[model samples]
Target chain A: MVDVVGSASSLHYAITGRPNCSLSAAGTCCVFLSIATITLIVAFGFFLAGAWVVLPFAGAELGALFWSLRYVCLHAGDYERLTIDHDKVLVEHHTTKQDVRFELNGYWARVILDCQPNGYCRRLALRSHGKEIEFGRFLSSEERLNVGRLLKSRLGGYLS
Target chain B: MATTIPIQDVHNEHHADNHPDHHPTGWMRWVMSTNHKDIGTLYLWFSFGMFLFAGALAMLIRAELFQPGLQFFQPNVFNQLTTMHGLIMIFGAIMPAFVGFANWQIPLMIGAPDMAFPRLNNWSFWLLPMAGLLLIGAFFVPGGAMAGGWTMYPPLFIQGGPSYDMTIFAIHIMGISSIMGSINIITTILNMRAPGMTLMKMPMFVWTWLITAFLLISAMPVLASAVTMLLMDRHFGTSFFNAAGGGDPVMYQHIFWFFGHPEVYIMILPAFGILSTIIPTFSRKPLFGYRSMVYATVVLASLAFIVWAHHMFTVGMPIASQLFFMYATMLIAVPTGVKVFNWTATMWKGSISFETPMLFAIAVVCLFTIGGFSGLVLAIVPVDIQLQDTYYVVAHFHYVLFSGAAMSIMGGIYYWLPKWTGHMYDERLGKIHFWLTAIAFNVTFFPMHFLGLAGMPRRIPDYALQFANFNMIVSLGAFVLGASQLLFLYTVIKCIRSGAVAGNRPWEGAETLEWTLPSPPPYHSFETAPVIK
Candidate 1:
């Protein structure tokens, strides 16, 4: 009974995995766009209230600069994930049991992202305990080679 | 899933083997206790004893003023009663009660097993009783007890008899106690919260205490310096507040009010926190705008330091300075207003019930607002010139202190009595005590405002016949109010000894990790830390 229920959930995960990347990206973009739009509206409202065209224009320009500065400071990370489970595409950042769980599916896939040199990384990259994997290696050219070599050695047998 | 870490569980197992047997019982346990809770109980009982003693002195003052002809005590004795009453109540009674509350509650609230420095807590509490003994003992000295009032404003204080010396000594001891107590409180609160209980997450009672302790550490030394100068002038022939020595009496007033103004808030802000806690519990609501309430307390504490000179406006400070102080004093109302609004908003649209604790909490809200409004009127430069040193000032502070701090202390006692005693108090006796005291308090103080507006100066043994009838009524009400406290004393004791057994969570509307433990909690509560979700 437990095996049947587990396999059914795994099937559901495999079907929903790959498309989640676009959903997350769209959500982030919407939030950023809304905040930027609000800043523009408030700046214009202030200008109209003051009834000084030049003064309000200068103020709005300053406001826009501040808005962009904060936006970059908050969310400079630019990486995306492509996950698979149950010998099929699973929910991105999601997984199921018994499908070579630690196997990295995406490779040399222009994973643009920010990386803090001294930042903490998660232990056991996907819980197979083969070795510690540096997950954000896609952020740099040299890191891509190091990560790809490690992944090939660990997951080559599991891949199709 | 929310993780449950029973930190107390670990502590109990670790400390169980180390627990002492053959622990000493009886009076020696009290005298030699290094435990925070035991010392806290000592401080509380000592404060209550002083409260009754000072209340007696107040009755004497009222009795002498009853018929306006120096009927009961002589003029000198009347002055002595007035002076000692204020001194005893401010330093001996109210301040000690607050320190007692801090000692008892702060450790339990913060989930610390005990005060950071238990020995220092014991020493500080012990000094209080010693100081009280010396001060009270001064009545039997070569001359009567000091008659220079609590401020002990120089010239008069220096000229008084040997009791003056005794009073100064007692003040020094009390100052040491307060400074030590404040330091201990500050250290404990800063150093001892459970993990995940960040500064913002701390209860308001703890926050107000943090500010009050800071006020004490900063201003208390200045007060000690001022009193030292007074002591020198009295004994060493140095003139700090003497005109002959080229020192000004007004300088004494400046130093006194610098300590006195924040001292008033120190007495009352804890009451504000207590009311904040009790009102929301009874109303069945999360305290509205918790962050704003925190900010408002900080603002009020910062403003308290700057507005000291408002107390000395009539002492002929520069007109500009007077105006500055006046406006600054009035600005206090803004932060104070935010607190009141937050409390009222917390109770809005909630399932409100009037328990004994709630009744006192509500009375505190209404009566303290009246006091705050009168304080606003007194803050006006022109009006203060008229009202300063009058019975109006007297009426103003009684509302603030008695109905404000004292009411909340009673409420806190009732609110936590079940947890402390493992039994519930008789509700009927508590309600009767509340109503009688509230009505009698207003009756005693309200007429003083009219008397002051009619130009009656305070601290006088005699008054004109025109103010006679109201004075008589106020005096009668004073006796009744004094008598009403017996009900509270009786109810507290009866509950402590034998009342209905209470469960772990006595109040259905209560929230707080403290409620998640057994009643009268074990000798050690929460041996293991409880995880905050």
Candidate 2:
């Protein structure tokens, strides 16, 4: 998804992308815990009915669920942000670990959409001077194409 | 646990995926692969292998019953055949086959790179063969396989020797595999969907699997618990089911069916999901009521938990409790009926086609409803008491599992094989396979209904001479049904080896994300997720 700051003609755009997570990190934890809670309650219900053997197995299963979902929640905020301004193009890739940065001279920067033979975009990038930086790594192929077209028309770049 | 890798950079490993040399060659590619498609292929082939083995066991059982006297193995061996056939088909064939479909199609349909936990997916597939070995190995143990039926009821279950422990250990292994697979499915569906692919927007197949995973997570452990108690009774001297030692065997029944009946849905709900997928595609109509289908599936799964005691009706609970279970079991028919109605209505005034997949889909709706009605008939306490261990009970489940779950899996294969293999299966042979299966299946199992009503108990090698005629007819049908599946195998091989090319979208009506990519999609084709409208 792309965001615009300041006036539309100011030529400053923020094209941002993140993992598609409808449930927030907390909500994900809540969902996992909720399922774990219900499963334990049911397992204990059976245990009290003299099926005590169910408790350990249920605990083991929930342990897996809890571990996996916690892993997912920890990375739910992983995101990417690229802003094009008058002089510089700044790309910030933020995961749980680090905020990596990439910069390009805006005047010489060129947007590229590397497409497969079937017209599916394989990668989207911006190249300037002699270096290149790939963006929209998290977006879908079709989404990259849309963002490519948007950036090309505004930046006055030609398709390769 | 966090899914963070370097961005704004090229990892040599990511780029190496394109180099042929970088990919593992030969058996290593399959045995230790993290690829979802490879794992799905392994699961499918493994299940089919198990299917044929179990099917051969069924043939032996039917052959022994062809006449009315002991012809082949002894009565004990006949019991072994029946018990192993039930256990293997349910565990090794039907359940895993659906999981195979889930492994392959779920990621494709949801537009994810792969399962959330790729290595775990590989582990899930590998564990099946080990479990299968123990199962088949049980037959070679000192006293032969457990003959106490697949339910493994105590007292009779306790009488068995070393083979019994092998079977229990096999089940424990399978439970672990199922739980791991379910966790991957649940996490992937809930977290890894492409942007715009919301929960409600997911395909019915995905929705069904999501619900089915929950059922597995909740019920499979209960099964592990029940079997663990049985193990304790055998070696640990805990009388959980030992009536001779201050315990009730009926309690085992209560606990087993608590896991077992949802197991019935665990096997079929995904098939219902398959029907929802195939019918609308063949009918050229949007599903008649998508939201209700989802709600009805949840309702059906919820009902499965309460209605398990219906299986134990003859074991004697209170009259009120019996009535409650009876009504609860019967209540399942309502959501089941809704699913059938929606499938029918989806075809109403639409461009319906009778492709092989469609043929199987239509047959499943009609035949599974027949099975559901039989279940309703048995839901009454009086009728259940009459039909409890009879061939009628056998007839009912075969109708659902064989015709319903098994057939849906076959249809789904036909529906998706073109996409998987990049070639259309021989339409001629596929149709023949379907007709032979549908016709011969009825010929084999239909008469069992009559044999059952006339009081021929199941799991017996011989019956009274009065039931001889129907037994002969049933045997003939089982043989023909068994033979037809070989044609199915040939058709698949022939399609994969040499058939007309199928471009990306083989079926014009297919609108899922998988179809949008190339047929036989690339190894990393889904690295960029597809957005739903």
Candidate 3:
């Protein structure tokens, strides 16, 4: 599905694939915090019962859980946007940490679908004049194919 | 998910469509991969390596007992071998092997894109090798590995040297790895199922894994707590198990078996799932009692928690408590019996094929039942009082673990190897391996029952002259069993290298979602969610 963000003079397609998190951010935090707190209480109980060595192991386990949850959530914000008109296509890619933009001549743009021998979609990239930007990393293979096809058809007439 | 091969012309349309996977090559591909398939491969291979290592330790234990007297190793060294053997086989071999299966099959079966948290999946697996190294590293320490058996009971456990600390630390690491793995699996199974694939409709392997994951989450923490206390008593002067320090030694047994009993169920529950999957497939029938099988699984897991005291029957408890644990432990046999009966009913008079996997499945039913009966024998307090810590207990668990968990794992491997490698192993050789394994396995552990009945105690490096004959037979069978495993290693490697090509559904009656995908599957399986009908 395409989410249009610009006027007719300059059309834009922004395809964002967030982590499939069913819970809201706050709900996610609450769930994890509950787990951590319960684990801590159990460990603390053991400590009070004279098994204090369990505390560090519990901390490490909670720490791993916290870090992994954070990593998944952070990557949920990743996005890829393609802004194009009659002249050029500008591609902006947003990872969890940084945003990168690649500018290419719209007339020279080509959409490449790296597919498997069995026709499974692998990767989708936009290439032009030795400059390329690959996106759809978080998309399903079918979604990637649709995105590839959309770009190909929209830019077919302008191919240099 | 609909399977469609991309048009070759479409591929030719672009210049940069050169490789299917953009991940790194060589060693870094394994270490850096967040892909489920890659991580699964790493886990399987690592577990196989540990299996051989642990199996070697078993061979040594047998070699020492070949003629009743310690021929090669000292008592302490022998104790270390037994201790490490149990720890490695349970933690390093069976558990990780099943987790590998979960990693490889769960996402494919559920039609999710991948595990819920792929990076954490990677982290969970890598921790295993480190934990294994620590356990192994204890051998090189100044005092050698801890000789206090894998159970790590206090007093004796607390008296060990520096290596005991290493062992305890290793247990903590492995426990954390298990807990993390269970969390990842639990989240993935709960939230990542395809649109139409409800829980009941999931494959038996997935169902069993879901239950087993919960068991892990519930059980491993107690083990972690127990070991943590062991560590504290050893170093921190805290006597949680020390009576002199106002702690009770038997309390450690209570805590350890609280985890240990469920731990046994944890190992076998997935095997139950594997057997359920295999039996129906070979019988050319839908599972006869699918819902009952799931119900039996849940009942069995719940029952596991209450039966912990059964193992301590001989430890001097009140008659009421003994009676309670005895009856509770014996009651486990009922649900387990339901499972066995269900498998038998599933295969009763159907158009059955005796393929290698089915052979292992059938053997597991017969042999594991024998193990179950022995467990029932041990469950009776009067009998257990006579048989505790005897060769009888050894025979009982080996039957359950070797013939149950280990055999089912081998069956699963055979059933899935074609799919995993995109090639069929040599059928003739496969059957040969199964026969050798089945025969040799029984010959190895079955005699221990008689030995136990005749009053042979377990975990000792030497035996009296009266028990010499059975030990000799068991040791000989152990040698044969150890050698037969090499045949399995050879079969797997040969299949991977140059076996015949396998189609998407290698087995004729297989009808799981995994069978709908191509053999060897793509690196990114289920890129789109598959709709289950």
Candidate 4:
């Protein structure tokens, strides 16, 4: 079997890709999306309100009723799932899936942690051959350690 | 070949091996605590204090409104009471309670040792009490506390009493505290996770908090700037919002709502997290649509920024602007609906029980829906035109804040009291508190809907004779509701002092890692991390 711990390091690199998608790029995308989406939603609320007011009393009530119905429709079902194997971590939801895998042999990998003193958990990062992958992006330190050990034990021999 | 690895040694290597004894003692401990749990406790106690303070103000307002025609205080003082009461409760009471929960639980649930920036946590928390002092101190100032509503819209705000500066300064400080707190939360959540804990496997509470933090960081600064401009207009003769200074007052509303709307979600999303955690545990089921809940929170946060203008529908923006805000505002219900349905589905066919926490969770679901329905009503331009600034609007938000947000917080406290105190709460007392709060809350706020429909405006000291009876009833309920909170405090204190000792997992149904540890968890938990199956 492939060494799981070593694979985790390689997997980290594959997940984050290269210098192409920098942290700044992701931050910019997040900012752009936030401003664009908020502006659109506020504009739409005004439109419906105006239409309701211009209409007669019954029309206004109908508008209110319709708004409620639409509200329910737009807000109601959406979630994602993640799983880990020896060579890769899999994130899947609905119709989408991303598999990140790594090769442990002849590659050096290091674990990086983000520690918080006030009640937040520390995060783990695996870096190998100039590429970095973060696991436990959603877990606390204890959970990360548990997962980390399993991978470490499995892949220790393959990684330098 | 045999190899022995000390579990503690391995655990220490994996986590931050900070020695708790090295921390300062006595009053300095509180001032310098970087421990999330310690900070969390500080936040909780502070919020409780603020709640009582605001409640006192509310009682005073109710006493004045008890018989109408102004009995207890003058109109100006009443306005101050109303305004300060709203500001204190929203900023000081409810929001801090949620943050308190976040600080305490996020690290434990995620299995991390602490928050990312512990020192910053201390700074964020200390700012609250100081801000509170300044705000309450405003009453002692020469002119008395501000009388404009909590929104603190300008023009009226600029011309307010001397205490206006104190209130504004306090607000600025509070806003700063919130932004820093949000930043800490986001960085910790984003950067910290143990091995194998993928984002999708994270708890709903963590996911919701992550989104709420994002909302706080992005929107709170805008509010700070808006208020800063208001301050400048008042003191420095700048006119960002003053019409005579070539600035439009409407511009202030736009900027304020942009921040204000998301701020509402920031207050409530954690409640959503609390409800999500409680409902699943009580139902004896894992949260249904776990990933969906995360998505829903993100979608809701995204939508919150857009729908803010709906608050200004009556302010006469162009038709296109109204349509956009209304539609966008309406769209938010979609993601929110997903969360509600997921909770209900989590309960469907599961071994559900009506423990006090679950009861509160259930009440939150039902009552908050009523609030949401009213929110939809407000989203419609014509309906809002009729209801805007009326008691109808009053009823709408009280449902959301009091019943929705506050109720969930209470439930969370009750659910975790045993865990925090190492003792089970008096169940009978808990039930009484729940029933009293539920009944009193409904009695207080439900009629405001009818009062609103009758066209009684809010924030007024006196009303016409026609609106007298409902107001009287509402005032009575308000007294009862205010009185009921004492029971909660008593219950918490009693449990902490001398309730029956609870073993690990006081609630047999609890599934989280927190329940796995002994009640009143050790100074250090999971010295040897427990493996998740």
Each model's C-alpha lDDT?
0.71, 0.87, 0.82, 0.74
lDDT tens digits by residue: candidate 1, B1-533: 22222212212112213322223469988888877767777887898889999999999898888886868877788888988988898889888888877877777777655665677788888888888998899888876888877788878887889888778788878987887787577656655565566778778888888778766655565566567778778888877678898877887787677678889988988888888889888999988888998888878877876798888787788888998999999999998899899999999998999989999999999999999999999999999999989999999999999999988888988988888789999999999999998899999999999999998999899999999999999999999999988888999999999999989888888886667767886555543344456
Q: Provide per-model DockQ scores.
A: 0.01, 0.33, 0.17, 0.03
Question: Which pairs of residues collide in candidate 3?
Answer: A119-B6, B1-B530
* Model 3: lDDT to the true structure: 0.82
> Residue B429 of candidate 3: its Cα lDDT?
89
Q: How accurate is candidate 2 locally (lDDT)?
A: 0.87
List interface RMSDs for the candidates, in order: 23.3, 6.2, 10.6, 17.3
Measured against the true structure, the TM-scores of the candidates, in listed sequence, are 0.75, 0.91, 0.86, 0.77
Q: Which stretches of model 1 miss by more than 4 angstroms? A: A1-160, B1-17, B20-24
lDDT tens per residue, model 3, A1-160: 1344554434554455543443345755875686677567756766776666557767776776677667656765667666675666666667767766666666667887766666667778876655446666557677777777777776643221
Tens-digit lDDT track for model 3 on B1-533? Answer: 21222222122233353444455679988998888888888888988999999999999999999886669999999999999999999999999999999999888888877888788789889999999999889989987898998999879999999889888888878887898888788667766777677778988889999889877765666788788788778888887899999988887887788789989988999899899989999999988888988998989988987889888876788989988888998899888988999999999988999999999999999999999999999998888889999999999999999999999999999999999999999889889999999989888998999999999888899989999988888989998989999999999999999889999998998888889888898776766576677
Task: Return whichever of 3 and 4 wins on lDDT.
Answer: 3
- Docking quality category of candidate 2 according to DockQ thresholds: acceptable
In model 1, what is the error at residue A143, expressed in angstroms?
42
lDDT of 4 at B418: 86
**Steric clash pairs (candidate 2):** none
lDDT per residue as tens, model 4, A1-160: 0012234444342121111111133543464355335433443443353311112322332233234223322322112222344444333222113222332332244544444565433455454554444455334355555555544453422221
Task: Please state the CAPRI-style docking class of candidate 3.
Answer: incorrect
Q: Residue-wise lDDT of candidate 2 within A112-142, one digit each (tens)? A: 7777677777677776553456778777778
**Top-TM-score candidate index:** 2
